[model samples]
Target: RVRFRDPAGATRTGEWTDAIECDGRSYDPAAVEVLPPCEPTKVVCVGRNYVAHADERGADVPDRPLLFLKPPNAVAGHGATVTLPTGVAGNRIEHEVELGAVVGERCRDVDPAEATGVLAGYTVVNDLSNRDDQRRETNWVRGKAFDGAAPMGPVLATPEEVPDDATVECRVDGEIRQRASREQMVFSVPELVSEVSRFLTLEPGDVIATGTPEGVGPVKDGDRLELTVDGVGTLQHTVRA
Candidate 1:
């Protein structure tokens, strides 16, 4: 389900049937461009927050959260075509699909027990990366924060609607590449929020990509990438060279 404005600018909420008519009104989804569901101050991401993901990369599981930031320039809406920077040699772009937690209010040093109260909703995000640039530089800002690197939304799901143990999956060109249960997370969402809150203040709409599961791989031009959260929704993007 989605809450959006019609081309006429009237706000409405209902099932996203992807059809021309919604609630007795005929409108084309393609004609009325859907914007990113949230406007975040920053997009914070967790690294190796999943045990299987850490193990797959031969990296030690962190005792605490490994946090990273993807600049606002990276944000993109559903149906966007992510461009490959021509200057970067051996671009080796890859997708790290994960569940995105959207903050609902300003918070600092929040109690983990009350973390859920600050969440606006959850959505899907494809954490696009330049693996070659990442492997060559210690800092991944240049690798992960490129324009259109993060494709999010289609819609947002309330926290109450998403179970803690929801399934997250990624598919490339219709083939499943990564799959796991949220229960495999090394740090739960509340714990992650609390950990991040210890240092950075989270405002309404600030997003946290709760890391990815195993099976991350490279994507090439013309590939279709889809990130799906069991209770959230699928966010799809096209790769462009």
Candidate 2:
């Protein structure tokens, strides 16, 4: 359920019981160093995948999946600090919690029916956005894809762990902000994988961010973001000015 660094600083794998067991040893979770569950080659994210999110943004629903990318450098581990870029406090840097599908095997031109077969597991992703740059520039490099923009982990769940429709939620300092079920997504995981693979190849350890629900708003420095995907564990991060 979790992969972490032991007190000795060696990487180990284990499942969550009441406590975590790794290297055939059980230890208090608070003593372990939690790492980002996956080292993705690339992070492939969808946009406006939820109908209500699209409606909130005053954008039309897309007939097909709208894809974007965040480089591997953007990933931050669980309990990490997400540094907000300077001068965006009033400009609207926001947090989006989404279901992240981790690719298991390399494949191309895979059908929707076979998409889940290529998945290694699922995790929670905080899709942080800088709205000012996003709206001012056509390319999202500065707006959506930036260092530490994607804080993930806490745990990576096997496909069997997630139900047909997992509920996703985002909270700021213990208050709920975003909430939705996977069923609310305009496109399903199968469709996204099938369609994305049609254009590019997917390799092992690549992450697909399924997108977030409505209720996305601004997050300030010192704000604590907790994103949960029900079956998948919660990812916690603090914003730093």
Candidate 3:
């Protein structure tokens, strides 16, 4: 598990086994600063890597893999508030729970069999989206690349601590919305690392957000999004106006 200073300037860590009191702090769990598990230069994400998710959206399953990027500035720590952009009235907002791979070592042209050796850890990530904006613009930048849109953490767990094929699930307001096993992924973690590294160098701390599963849907203000990757931890955030 990782440690972080909440908005109230208190150093709280998820590794601990007890509840942490806020002590009347004005901080909202939905709005907090995020620091990288390790310093990273890039965040690479796979799109539609799950056949069921791709089919649900009428997107074709890729022959290889579709990838995208989220700038480092877009990273938000656990409990960070995700804001809905002004005047994006008709856009639908959705929560995507994904298993994020944290690279532990720098690599280039890595072999799939050796990819796990380079992994630093794992973290739960919510890949927030604005569907209308994405569909209309023909580019994902504006839709998926927004401030605090990528809420990750609670803590990063070392590979030895988390079994590679853990289950990943997403819930909104205590109700399960998306569920899938890592075993269902069209591409394995090692394959992702090997494929991604073939195109670009991967540095320690760089994160690769493996694609979400089926059951993608809308969310609104005041809703709490809980993402859990077994053996890692749960990451919670609330939507705000």
**Candidate 1 lDDT, 93-145, residue by residue in tens:** 88998899999999999899999888998999899889888878888977888
Error of 1 at 95 (Å): 0.6
| Pairs of residues at least 3 apart in sequence or in different chains that clash in candidate 3 | 2-155, 30-80, 30-81
TM-score of each: 0.91, 0.96, 0.88
Whose TM-score is higher: candidate 1's or candidate 2's?
A: 2
Worst 10 residues of 1 by lDDT: 13-22
lDDT of 3 by residue, 9-125 (tens): 766544423442344334443354544444457778889988999999998989887888888766887676778766664868888999999998889999999999999888888
What lDDT does each candidate get?
Answer: 0.85, 0.89, 0.81
Cα error, residue 23 of model 1, in Å, equals 9.4
Among all windows of 10 consecutive residues in model 3, the one with the lowest summed lDDT is 16-25
- Model 3 C-alpha RMSD to native: 4.1
Which residue pairs in candidate 1 collide?
A: none
How close to the true structure is residue 51 of candidate 2, measured as C-alpha lDDT?
91
Q: RMSD in angstroms, candidate 1? A: 2.4
Model 1 lDDT, residue 90, Cα: 84
Model 3 regions more than 4 Å off:
6-14, 19-39
Sorted by TM-score, highest first, which candidate order results? 2, 1, 3
